[model samples]
Target: MTEDLEALRSAPVLETERLLLRPFTAEELDAVAAGEAVAHFAHGFPSAEDMDFARESLMAGGYFFTESVYARLAVVEKSTGEVVGTAGFVGPPIDDELEIVGSLAAGRRNRGYAQEAVTALRGVAFRDPAVTGIRASVPEDNAPAEQVLVAAGFVRRGTPGLETEYFLPRPA
Candidate 1:
């Protein structure tokens, strides 16, 4: 685990071929929680659920400011420089296992963006030697989301129910 909590607060900016996963600034998180429009947010971005998550994360001292590898990162589309969604660790590692959550704008789904972001997150989580595994849960009916996890090398860990749990162990 990184000994410096402050260093972890500033998450490294992760870039994929088409997406940029950068930590959300305090100002942006505040604006999101208040339902105010952020300039770079894409249309229909930050849905009610997203807003609630942002508010809750901020209320918990800003997820990024905690000991997690990364906080809530705005998933930006490179071509337009617009935030199409958000993704990050749910909280700091527990038993060397961390949970992650991510979502894209409704209009931007099914273009490989979710998988790309999840893969990047997996990369970040594994970078910390203390993180032995990562996990995610998707509603059973959300086949697309499940597919994204699978594409990112996460395997289903239990029987499907209201939500299906997935896990990815640190690479050898």
Candidate 2:
């Protein structure tokens, strides 16, 4: 609910079995904010124009904080402490329901880091009294992402057709 950038500034790194997620940097924020990283997704990357638009609407609004502020931490390899990619939520709408963590980086896909990252992030998310559920939206054709979420305890709760929705509660 709070959009204070200071709230996320200097946030502690979140640890996982094989990864560490630290707050996103201004450079990384600019890259994502500028749509430079969209080519990595199965879904069409956000265009520079789109990112420019979002810069004002989403970035400026601190949405990445909850709705779209750049509150993400870099996802890194635990053993090497090398950055593998990023993990965290992207929208305020999700915060009001389930804390939705966007998936991991393209290079890091299939490494099971996504699963491990979410597993850890969910623990942190659920620690808050308002959090009740956690959810993710994997493209219908993204088998790897679906596998990661399913393996992490998210089960289908909607129609099996396109855009199917799956959900899981925060660990009690």
Which candidate has the top score in TM-score?
1
- Name the lDDT value of residue 137 in candidate 2: 64
Candidate 1 lDDT over residue span 107-142, tens digit each = 889899988888888888877778999999888889
lDDT minimum window of 10 residues, candidate 1 = 63-72
Clashing residue pairs for model 1: none
Tens digit of lDDT per residue, candidate 2, span 1-172?
Answer: 4654444332446776677777655554566566664332223233443344336544465445522323445566777555556566543335545545454445456777788887877765565556678777665887877777788899877665576566877566
RMSD after Cα superposition, model 1: 2.5
The number of the candidate with the highest lDDT is 1
TM-score to native of every candidate shown: 0.88, 0.67
